[model samples]
Target: MSTTQSDRLRELLEPLVAAKDLDLEEIEVSRAGRRRMLRIVVDSEEGVELDACAEVSRAISEKLDESDAMGDEEYVLEVSSPGADRPLTEHRHYVRAVGRLVKLTLTDDAELIARILVVDEAGLDLEVPGVKGRKPTARRVEFADIAKARIEVEFNRKDQNEEDVTDEKEEEA
Candidate 1:
């Protein structure tokens, strides 16, 4: 996949996505069997809903159809939100994942599991989980030092589960 084509696609699609009040997270073109596959990932602070994805898909598909961007090749257009486990490469990804636990791999190959407390252009403020009954410590990690970062799924989150149960009970009452 050529970076030029991807950059062109980003240039073309970014405004369309921004007009709809969403961020164009990523655009990738890959060979799928005989045809090509264009995957567009869109996201928003409020989160991307199914309708939002469909709307972006429709708009992007129409734009692609009108333009000769795909070079007369039949391609599949798939627009979607970034998955929960998607790498936090962009600043907005970190902002969106605030309050969520994340596993970050540093450039030095050090791994840290921390809850995102803040995100700025330069770096992130994370609450590193304490061990042995100690309190969590606040740590700052610059984006340049982060090699990889992904949200960690907390399966047995008692606080969140209790809140959900309470909301359900209230709704039932």
Candidate 2:
């Protein structure tokens, strides 16, 4: 889709998303043969609920129906949550994934498995484990060369403490 159309779609969807108390992660419009597909990914601080997805889907469908954006083409509208394995695309996404393990593929044919240590204007600082004669290294990655990245979910949950919970609650408060 054209940039203008993409911007217009974002503008149109923002209010609907806000009304439903959800975050609009992305909107994709694609055509396959004679059919068009409109996919919307939405989320929230507490994660997305099925009712919220249904609500946003209904609102977006109504708006699209009224605007006739597809111009008589049959289109399928699908609304969903960015699943646990969702790709990290934005700066905020990277920031939120900090302290979690991630697999990143760089442009230089380097694949890294590391824990996200920090995110700053310069780039991401990842703690990569040692190999052979190399010590555990913290590498700074430019924001540009990250071809693909996603948070790695560990099967084992780390232990937490009362102090940790208290600190988190204080911060939220």
Best by lDDT: 1
lDDT of 2 by residue, 69-136 (tens): 65787988899999777788888788877878888988887888888899997679999978897888
lDDT of 2 at 150: 84
The worst-scoring run of ten residues by lDDT in candidate 1 lies at 153-162
User: TM-score per candidate, in order?
Assistant: 0.85, 0.72
Model 1 lDDT at residue 61: 86
Clashing pairs in 1: none
List lDDT for all candidates, in order. Answer: 0.91, 0.83
> Each model's RMSD to truth, in Å?
3.4, 5.5
Model 1 per-residue lDDT tens digits across residues 1-173: 55688888898889999999999988989999999999999999999999999998999888888888788888999999988788888887898898899999999999999999998889999999999999999999999999999999887666767899999999999
